[model samples]
Target: MERAKPSSIKRATALRYMGASGWQPDDATTALLDRAEEKILAAATPRAAVRRLPRAVFPPPELDCGTDLTRHLQGCDAVLLMAATLGSQVDSLLRRLELTDIAMAAAADALSSVLLEQICDELEAEWRAKFAAEHLYLTGRYAPGYGDCPLELNDELCLAVDTVRGCGLAITPQHLLAPRKSTTAILGIADHPVTGTLAGCTTCHLRETCSFRKQGTTCFAK
Candidate 1:
């Protein structure tokens, strides 16, 4: 298991998660977000685990992750299965806030989402450099539930990475990641650089009903 240091969340990213992109927050809202960020940072403990496996071992035998993921991994020699979490303390903080201050709780939730992504981003950077040293390249990180990929694949991914024992990451019966701010993903290890990968709302499974799209924005909106 690899531990990551807590980092500051991008305010814009958190605002996007909060559905407040392009809308200037008033002083009160800004202060609320500031406090939320502080609390979330104090409560989060980022950790991750990665398992590199042969391409043949991916998708497991009984499951199909659809063509999008298949195409993403085409020609790759190996797969990097990864799991990460913001830890249970953040979940506990949110639960406590939900009892008294709904707005604060919501803000903290959004910030926590952004914080988790930041942790993943840092990990990706590390992986990139580490692989580059071996003269290899990586495809973008593709998580289950991203496009045609079945969300249930998360179960297999968690198992592959030993997420529960490694980082206390688990999937609930509802198939959602426990701790609320954890993720599982895979990346292709290609001898050559991978290109033309589709990302953002275009490939997202929730595109049809995405609140960001309905609001004339995107989750990736800056």
Candidate 2:
């Protein structure tokens, strides 16, 4: 579900979205993204069927991330899909790309790495404001290529949320999402509450069993 923007908090919050590194937005790109965001917000979307994921983790296992993940994901009420299609990022650097539609791929990669989080942050805060509550904390996002979670599950999760029809977000066979500006993710509801920062799969001792951690950089925390 889309949430209202907290105009009073936009400036400060944008920095928060940027975090310690500070996400600086280019004027032209910011304008484009803002417009796209507006259009997306203006469009009517169906209320997604929200379920508290029995387990939540960066790399979903055959049966969901183990106990700690379940413990952490406990209080989330909905999954925020930060529409990600890195096509645009790569598109800008097309000259250096060697793949098909290199431009789109490059664009998508950059977008996925940079903008998706910020967009999701803005969306997350807005959603919180709409409910007049703050229980909607991100339970950390679980992408494909992490654990036993099949890269294929991306399709199932997106479908469960009615992503394409609802928000015009789509994923490709290569595990890339479309719209070059869209993203999809799961947010399970948590009646209880979790504290502190979100943890990456690497932090979990079970990461040895995780597919993503092996690639380096823990998903939860450094």
Candidate 3:
């Protein structure tokens, strides 16, 4: 897949990622966020790869994604595996800021998280338009480690999309994306409209302990 221009990341979304809620930033805080956004945007070189496969052939049997994801894909005939990253330069930038300014690093980290999600959202929008022409509908994108999906599937997802060769995306031994701002997800393509497929607190493993939930909000809240 080709890179598309990213939509601007909203301050509220970035603040949510930083575990802040029901709070308004002062002028100093806003300036810190601005600097973080600037550095992250300068360092970001977003790229992605996608692979479409028949539902029957997905998950590869050996990897068990559990019942929640199975339910999420119930009516779909095909699946799209996608991987995306903001490049290693962004990772390097965060590391340097951590040494010089912890607060700036934290802000940058949250902003990077928001930026990566924005890229994925744009990719989904593009695919939605493309599939619309084919009369196909897509379930919301679901990433590994959500609900009962195993994080180990990240390795398989990276391979399926050839992310390493296609976008220089990599998985660390801990089953985490190496760039620290990368993501891998799957979307189900169905003949009819699909609902309740979006990732939310109800299906999230961290739901109980999630700070966002405690604050009367969710990570996915607009």
* Clash list (residue pairs), candidate 1: none
Of models 1 and 2, which has the larger TM-score?
1
Candidate 1, which ten residues in sequence have the lowest lDDT sum?
Answer: 195-204
Question: Lowest summed-lDDT stretch of 10 residues in model 2?
Answer: 43-52
Question: Please, what are the lDDT tens digits per residue for candidate 2 over residues 1-222?
Answer: 443322222333333323322457678646644543343333313122222344433224564444443444455644444333323333334333335544333333443344445555565555445444744444455444443334466676666556665555677887665644455555444444434234455445466755334554443432
Q: lDDT per residue, candidate 1, 1-222, as tens digits? A: 656666567897778777777678899999999999999999998899999999888988568787788888888989988899989999999999999999999999999988888889889889989999999988878888887888899988998888999999999886789988898889999898884254667667899899988998766555
Compared with the true structure, what per-residue lDDT tens digits does model 3 show for residues 59-135? 77777787788888989989989998999999999999999999999999999898888899889898999999999
**Cα TM-score per model:** 0.92, 0.47, 0.92
Candidate 1: regions farther than 4 A off: 199-204
Query: Which is the winner by TM-score between candidate 2 and candidate 3?
Result: 3
Task: Put the candidates in lDDT order, highest first.
Answer: 1, 3, 2
